[model samples]
Target: MNSDLLILDYEPAHQPAFRALNHEWIAHYFTIEPIDNEMLDDPEGYILAPGGHIFMASHGGAIVGTCALIKEHKGVYELAKMAVSPRAQGLGIGWALGQAVVAKARQLGAHRVELLSNARLRPALALYAKLGFRHVPVPPTPYQRTNVKMVLDL
Candidate 1:
């Protein structure tokens, strides 16, 4: 593989890969399913709702990572659903996808970004912090697994 990952918008054909990415990490860190097939198939419904955008990282011909940006408030965006294949971690694909999301947010005229994560995901939290995301108190949500909230000012 070239290893030069290209980040692009969600496409119907890439849903399987995206779902696999989500499932893999969810299985590792949380007991619940992160995303179901139906949700992946209906990208526009859940993933793309709230003015959100999905992105995937492709290297050679395979999708290796995925991320999403959801509109939170006026000029505020929520960065969500970031996952990299286990085989693809340590290759900077996660960072690539994150920068892509930030660039996407900039392109969309967003002023800030935020994300929800679990304390169990230390690597991901470290990566977000390295990328300038500061931790905030966790929000009260139905999802019990989430323990940290990260925010970034663009």
Candidate 2:
């Protein structure tokens, strides 16, 4: 990661960057589902307003990646929408975003963090494991693309 890389909370101005970054990666691998459209279209409504948090990674003042922790239940959260710009993949931006989310989840008083991912995304799966997430049975989710689920206790 660059020394200049910064991870920060979501702002209204960051809405477009957040949607574009996630859409780029999702479109590259799978079609965006309606649920995806709904959430991406109004993150502050669906995410932040509902007791969740979103974070963005910026480099040289450009948004390069983003991730969010969506509250699933009291003290439980789902880590989702993690994406780095195609040009920034493999540069540890995703990992940095993940770490930031985990820390934020704890700060939010969460007891656990969970995520659903596709088996085809080996790199992401590895990153989750490296971040101390362990394999778990898939939970009900709107995304048909999910084939693997993981969880980490805070």
Best-matching candidate per lDDT: 2
TM-score of each: 0.89, 0.96
In candidate 1, stretches whose alpha carbon ends up further than 4 angstroms from where it belongs are 1-3, 33-41
Candidate 2 residue-wise lDDT, 1-154, digit = tens: 6787899989999999989998999999999999998998899999999999999999777899999999999999999999988777777898899999999999989999999999999999999999999998887777899999999999
Off by over 4 Å in 2: none
Worst 10 residues of 1 by lDDT: 32-41
Per-residue alpha-carbon lDDT of candidate 1 for residues 7-80, written as tens digits (9 for 90 to 100)? 88897887788778887887777765434445555667776766879999987667889998878788899888
| Prediction 1 global C-alpha lDDT | 0.82
**Model 2: per-residue Cα lDDT at residue 39:** 91
Model 2 pairs in collision:
none
Query: Largest TM-score belongs to which candidate?
Result: 2
